[model samples]
Target: MARTSRAPRADAARNRDKLLAAAAKVFGERGLDAPLEEVARRAEVSIGTLYNHFPARRDLIDAIFPVRLAALEQVADAALAEADPWKGFVLFVEGLFALQARDRGLNDVLARRYPASPELSGACHRGFVHLVEIIERARGAGLREDFEAQDMAPLMWAMSQVIRETADVAPDAWRRFLAFHLDGLRAGAAGPLPAGPLTEEQARGRPGEPAGSPGR
Candidate 1:
């Protein structure tokens, strides 16, 4: 007879929950590369228990970031639903930067690729598609004629850098930089450019590259 898998025991389930919660806390403070040992310690569990639950860092990351990824999609949806495309575009950009400013883990997630995690990779691709639609709508409404869908990734990458550098010292400083970038993105602000925007594949990064590659 074939054997069926049994559900986890109550204590084991509790330990799993603790580990996930601790991981969320640790990754929020540090980046996704934060130590798994720290997460185990924070959960008051042994490293063995954490490994039992997550098996690997990618597994832990895959478990912890879905909610944040969903939140980003919701922001995109909300912005897309706005009647004014310009307002929608602005809201999308501002919302993204605000989330990154607050969550270091999310900043890392947004700024990188995770090829090994299919769920996270799919979510990122979907988010990029949403951005493409949003940008198209904004352009249709006569905003940022020079802007391309691929430009969004580079912009977010730049903002992530600014957020990383200034977040501790001036948590809100990214806002000022974003505002300046927004100004430059305005319709009438278009001027002769030095070079064309990066291609979508280029903006999304090459395979096997580091997670937080600017292309991502």
Candidate 2:
């Protein structure tokens, strides 16, 4: 007879679930770099147990973010369906900013790449392509001929910072900032800027640097 695969032990399964829940909470509050021990502590488990369930930080991130990434893609798809290119572009940007404002973990995910996680990397790549399409459509509609898709990274990075700093004192502060930036992006907003946009590779975040490192 062929050997049968064994199911996870009941306690092991429960521990995994607890770890995931705690990780989502901690990562949401502190970003992906939060200490693993905190997740274990919140899950009411030992650190060793947490390691047993997820051998690496990337493993834990992979488990927690697939749904969130899928949701982001859905938002992109919705924006792409809008008939007006400028409207679509605005909707896409606002949707992305809203997502970052709502979920700290997702904010980090958008701004950074965990190189070991292929799934996350692929999802981010797709999102980048979608952004290019949105930018092209808007340009074709005479909205912002000077705009470049690569400009999105720095913009998102700045917006994330705005959200982080003003979350408590002025939760809607990013709206004011975004409005000013958007006006500058309009077709005839001003004379051409001196510096060129960053390359896509640069916008993707530099290796060994935190996502959206301004120094880059």
Candidate 3:
């Protein structure tokens, strides 16, 4: 007997898309531990349908990761186009952090594994290179201080680590933290950003911040 391939019904295609979108959100928030069955439920599909599309968890995760990267690239590219390099760098970092905060699973799982690989690291390196170019341009105009490109790489890595593992810190303090991080990189050699891998126990951010706290 010969193998027969069948085109999925139209409804099956819609269900597959819904599953991917919901799984992206669920996995982004909760990590890939989210059950496929649960994803199917959230997407209003049946488990059989999900399995039909994503046969394995890794398949789903790997697929979603690239899609997420594309979205981030678009946002960062727009931010990098700002006239002020300093402002552009700050906004780019801000957008980057927001994506991680909203999707801790991606930061914790995919990012940690990829950053250590040079080929994998290059994708992210582009973002930092773009940031450094902006900062240098700002400095040339005396709108910013002298900052090296190399500094932004580890700053980005450290900030992502801090955001991912330190869930105890209240969310509202992120902008203040970003400001603190950026301030150190400004023209004058300010002090250091606390070396991250900062556990929740380490951050002294406001506990249960008020509604109007900065960046809320």
Best by TM-score: 1
| Arranged by lDDT, best first | 1, 2, 3
User: On residues 1-216, what C-alpha lDDT tens digit does candidate 1 reach at each position?
Assistant: 123333446678999999989989998887777788899999999999998888878888888786677788888989999999999999999998888887898888888734436788787777656887888889947577879987887888889889988978998999999999988888888788899999867987723446453221
Worst-scoring 10-residue span by lDDT in model 3:
207-216
Positional deviation of 6 in candidate 1, in angstroms? 8.6
In model 3, pairs of residues that clash are: 145-187
2 versus 3: better lDDT goes to: 2
The root-mean-square deviation over C-alpha atoms between each candidate and the true structure, in angstroms, is 4.3, 4.3, 9.1
Instruction: List runs of model 2 lying over 4 Å from the truth.
Output: 1-8, 113-116, 140-142, 207-216
Q: Candidates' lDDT values, in order?
A: 0.81, 0.79, 0.60
Residue by residue across 60-144, what tens digits does model 3's lDDT show?
A: 6655665465556765677768877667767777787877777865664324532123433444444344654566666744333
Write candidate 2's Cα lDDT for 108-199 as tens digits. 77766344367877776766568778889899574678788888888888888788778778878888999898888888775778999998
Question: Looking at candidate 2, what is the lDDT of residue 125?
Answer: 71
User: In model 1, where is the ten-residue run with the lowest total lDDT?
Assistant: 207-216
Cα error of candidate 3 at position 69, Å: 2.1
